[model samples]
Target chain A: MTNWQEDIVLDCSGLNCPLPVLKTKKIMDGLDSGQVLKMISTDPGSVNDVAAWAKRTGNELLETVADAGEYTHFLKKRH
Target chain B: MVETAGKKKRMALIASKGTLDWAYPPFILASTGAAMEMEVGVFFTFYGLTLLKKEISPKVSPHSNPAMPMKMPFGPDGFQQIEWPIPNILTGNMPGFETVATSLMKQTFQKKGVATIEELRDICIESDVRLIGCQMTMDVFGFSKDDFIDEVDIGGAATFLEFAAEADIQMFI
Candidate 1:
């Protein structure tokens, strides 16, 4: 994981496909450009979903870590 | 090409099934598309029109439809743990079995923390996803404008096709 400080943290554990990315998008919309958000998810689908979400939303995915079936993603708002 | 260059990304989705299990795809995809700044439109055709109705909660029961897959939150191990055969005959024959099965499925969804159908519909509305009911199906089914939710619009196949033509992604669910 990157050392960048997170402006906000969203925990989407126990949620299934679409919820993690959907929740992330909702939270990211409120963030200003360059602000970072850390997302925690337990759904395996999120591994791909978060990456695609960041790309589609024009955000920067700074880091992604998977540990003990839990995934953590760090994203920076672009616009 | 240049005329469409500045336009926003768009998606057109067709919902053709009315089963509760089938209901998730169109709304989920629409909400996700909307979140990614895409203009999303969902066309509810045939039985799918039931989903647009006000105060009507459609249901799915594996007991009634043998082809319908049972989704348990516990994964493959959940099946092995139960050690039950496919199409449990007892459950299928029981009185009010559909109601029981539907409730069980709803409970599974809750345990998984997934959004409910109603919540997902609201999400679509909040995200500005357009919901269009098929005019032909509505007529055949004897449905009126008052049958659908306030956010729904009634349209024909041609109207949906017009939206589909401009969309970057098209899905039939």
Candidate 2:
């Protein structure tokens, strides 16, 4: 995967369901189009949640890395 | 995407239980749905109306809830820890176990870094999750509109079903 410059890095470790997604959306809402976001979540549900959120919101999923119970995702704002 | 700004997918949930344990599901799903850019609504009915009450911080009653597992203060962090399961016979003998269990649950959630019910409610409201208090339940329970928190809508079953009928996801919790 290409290294896209992350405009925002959201650390969602220790957060359970709904929080990771909610905080991600809140941050993503403030980002400009074409800007990138890097989100790290400890919740396993976020693996599918972030991907689905990207798909549902028309954002571009650039990279994803899962390491030792933590998930890292890079997404670009589409609109 | 251009034409679908306000026309995002919708989700509706019926909250029927008022216990602390029962409160998590509806708000969790509703808040996540809103985060996913969907319109979310949670209709509080029956005993669930207590969830929307302004002064009531609902507590779990382990006296009747046998399914709630007791959590240790520590997680499974590669260190092997022996867990001695307490016999229900012993627990049943202990008085005031319900209060102890309820506080324990709250402590466990705090230790796990999970949000409290108050925080989750705020998140749901901020994320645009519509909170509708069942009017019939309120009337039966002698609760007025002022009994609930701000930003709550009072409605009946038909009102909730209207949103549920068009929602992609409908839940009865």
Candidate 3:
């Protein structure tokens, strides 16, 4: 609900571990530096996984929003 | 472990099993490691070398595994949650039981939105994760380089050790 902007949207709902992170990396690879991506996932594990993946891959995780059972993450591609 | 500045972390995994249930760990870890920007290599040896075949149909046999739960992939939630206690004798002696179990497991994985082993292996290859097949195993099993997918590199133990020695994480699966 915040005013964050994104250059691409990836929906990974119903997918499990590694898939979410894998798909996120695939999309991020195609994005230009500073471009933002909004990814939504239904896997509860992704809450921590996204943060860890962002840190390890040097991407910036702007914020994560949990709405009901779904978790939405906003990430910026690293320069 | 000493952290070398500006060097990517490396992971080395040895896969030695070929069962459907056991085949997942190496590919899953390798692909994920690559996604995390780590250098990853998976050495396939013994029965695990079969996983590198162009057409792999790994089957699960719950005959000796007492802890494996039998669950249906379809039906109502309550029905699906109920684990059927299948006798080991039937699972072990019944012909085509392994095929049934394999299909059921695949169905459950599909229902749960899990990726197939082949899909994960494709991701590993796409991410440049090094897949090394054991040359000794290939010779013993009469497997030629053409028998496996094009992405696999055939090597001996020394090749795997060379990569694993520098790896931050090493696993035997």
Best by DockQ: 2
When sorted by TM-score, best at the front, the candidate numbers are 3, 1, 2
Best by TM-score: 3
Candidate 1 chain B weakest ten by summed lDDT:
B78-87
Judge the docking of candidate 3 as incorrect, acceptable, medium or high: medium
Q: How many clashing pairs per prediction, in order?
A: 0, 0, 0
- DockQ for each numbered candidate: 0.54, 0.62, 0.55
Candidate structures ordered by lDDT, highest first: 3, 1, 2
State how far residue B146 of model 2 sits from its true place (Å): 1.7
Span of ten consecutive residues with least summed lDDT in model 3 chain A? A1-10
Q: Write the per-residue lDDT of candidate 1 for residues B28-48, one digit (tens) a residue.
A: 899889887889999999989
| TM-score per candidate for chain A alone | 0.95, 0.92, 0.96
Model 3 scores a TM of: 0.96
Q: For every candidate structure, what is the RMSD over all alpha carbons to the true structure, in angstroms?
A: 3.2, 2.6, 1.9
In candidate 3, stretches whose alpha carbon ends up further than 4 angstroms from where it belongs are: B1-5
Instruction: DockQ for candidate 3, please give it.
Output: 0.55
Ranking by DockQ: 2, 3, 1
